[model samples]
Target: MNRSKPKAPAPDEPLPVEIVDAHTHLDACGAKDAADVTAMLDRAAAVGVGRVVTVANDLTAARWAAEAATWDERVFAAVAVHPTRTAVFSEQDRAVVAELAGRDRVVAVGETGLDFYWDYSPPAAQEEAFRWHIDLAKRVGKPLMIHDRDAHEDIWRVLEAEGPPETVVFHCFSGDLEFARRCVDRGYVLSLAGTVTFRNARALREAAVHIPTYQLLVETDAPFLTPHPFRGRPGEPYCAAYTLRDLAQLRGADVAELGAAVAANAQRVFRLPAVTARELRGREG
Candidate 1:
């Protein structure tokens, strides 16, 4: 399939505080090599998107994400066979994902979970893979990043049945306030993406307002779900600034304060190492 290329708009005003892009696909965003990744990160950093977690949906992409994390101190990785690809998931695929999940820079064990919208994979296959990934996340002692789409109940059921990992994050959370409350009550983190910026996403925006600051995170899910005003265009980690700003407005909170809280939540959830001032400056230099 020919995918639309990302649209690069002029960078937004710099955020008063730095934040992390909890989930993105650097490879799918057309970042081919170290130089390309660096260039993207450079643009992100200029707007205070200081760190990013590039995720993978398959074995080859998983390998690339792991290597990309090592390329920059600011980049981390999450690896798994996406739910849609679970139909073809095999023992070898499982082994590779398990291996990658244990890597130093592979901070999360997902982009996994249920996706019932597409018929590409059977529900059984998706469930089985979701269970396996849940186990993998527990075994590797990393947070489980979920990709729930039109399968919220099944997603919750499987997670409850499998006994989710200590840290469970609903990537690009698509539920309303009630679902958000359920997740929050269960101690799950909700990572909001650009979709929250859409005018028609009233429910999503409302959910965002109710989520406690400590349980909130921000992501771009780049190359897709670009924020409004730039919707239908490409998105990147830097574009997270737009989402963060919008979210802060919805919550009636200060942008810098919210950014700091979200950054802390990401660090705690992903167990990211604290970057020294010297190292941070070196990257900026």
Candidate 2:
């Protein structure tokens, strides 16, 4: 099935208020060094996406993400072996992820959890790895970022069983209203991505409308899940501006107001420093 490379969306106006991309993948977006990493974040910062938490889905990405975060003050890292890649997950792998997860720039232990949508890893292996990441997050006192896909019930079940970390962020949250409510009620932060902008994502929009400001966040999940009108395009951290506008419209909230809240929530959950956003804005001007 050969297909053309998706077009990139043209940049939108920078938001009036700054925001953080709660999760994204600088490495997967084709960044390979300090210069590449800086270029990406520069594009994002130019559009008011002042900071981003680049997440890892495997050991290779985990190492890249940790180092990439240090390339720029605005980039942070989340390291984990994704559930789909957990088939070969071992004590050795856990040790490596743990070491990376402990880095000061690594703010969360994740993109971990079950993804029944793909058979890359058996359910048992996924569960084991998820539990290990959960414990690591707790031990290191960092938030746990999840990648739930068609395994919502068991996702909650596992989190419950392990007594979740102090903060849990559902990265690229795909749940409908009911599940969103459950997550919100449990005090989990929902990091909505470009999916919320899709015309077909009715239920996700419904969930977005009800999420309290304090418990809500936004992300690009890019180089994938680009927002509507540009749904088929490759997304970037800068695309957070588009999603934020659409999300604000859906929730009937002012764009700047919602952006502020989303930014605040990302900082609180990821424990990212707030000073940089202001400094970034000053430089962008």
Candidate 3:
């Protein structure tokens, strides 16, 4: 059970409790082959992650995930043009994204929002692309996963304009406590990732403490933000355990209780099937 070993999980494995990684980039997780994905999923299943919402940054990634989802029951896809890639969302890109949204495996439209931190695309372009994603999510009757980085105010402005999405989630939410309050007032779900388990991520910790439990979610954003204790290593979906523990500590709740709640939250937002502990155990075996 070494972290780096690649192996197949038993077809009907069982886990102690099921976990749902509300966000991740499986394409970026070095899972370029079936063996790689099996290893990833096995490691995750070993640690209780039963499902994950894998986000794609562009049309190519969307197509990749769309195909992957058909092969892995535990993997679900989210299609969108990332903010940094806004300038690349050509007409063809929009058509493909639209088409992908119609797929059964595609659950959300996202990782679309303002990222002033990188500014890879012009502000106007990012905004326009973000609005388009919101519109697509609305049309498709799916949730919207936003990625706001140093552009909180602008995100708020656009959110106010578009109004609440069918289900609105702030992926890898790093906003301040006041912004957290604003998001809560708007009934937005805040998804905390591995960053919340970092010692210096007091803002994320604060958000975990203050945000309503029902409005909070956990994700790995895998291949990134591996969280404390496992920092400095390639992240994976199983690391949701660390995030779950951290949030439980922040909210003064039991680990198992928090795990169950986050798993349910992920299912609700993504419209994923709810697996009983029995089914989760069978998958882990």
Candidate 1 deviant stretches above 4 angstroms:
1-6, 276-279, 283-285
Question: In candidate 1, how many clashes are counted?
Answer: 1
Residue range 41-116, candidate 2, lDDT tens digits: 8898888888999999899999999998887888999999999999998789999999999999999999999999
lDDT tens digits by residue: candidate 1, 120-234: 9999999999999999999999999999999999999998888988999999999999999999999999999999999999999989999998999999999789897899887
Query: Per-residue CA lDDT of candidate 3, range 1-285, in tens?
Result: 657743322222333467788898888987876667767776777778878888998878888888777767788889998999997678888999999988998999987999999858999999999999999999999999999989999999998898757689999999889999999988899999988888888776777789888888899898788877676667778777777876778789887787778888888888887664348557778
Which window of 10 residues has the lowest lDDT sum in candidate 1?
Answer: 274-283
Q: Which parts of model 2 are misplaced by more than 4 Å?
A: 1-4, 278-285
Each model's lDDT: 0.92, 0.91, 0.83
| Alpha-carbon shift of residue 173 in model 2 (angstroms) | 1.1
Sorted by lDDT (best first), the order is 1, 2, 3
Highest lDDT scorer? 1
Candidate 3's C-alpha runs over 4 A off are 1-16, 276-285
RMSD of each predicted structure: 2.3, 1.7, 4.5
Candidate 1 residue 154 C-alpha distance from true site, Å? 0.4
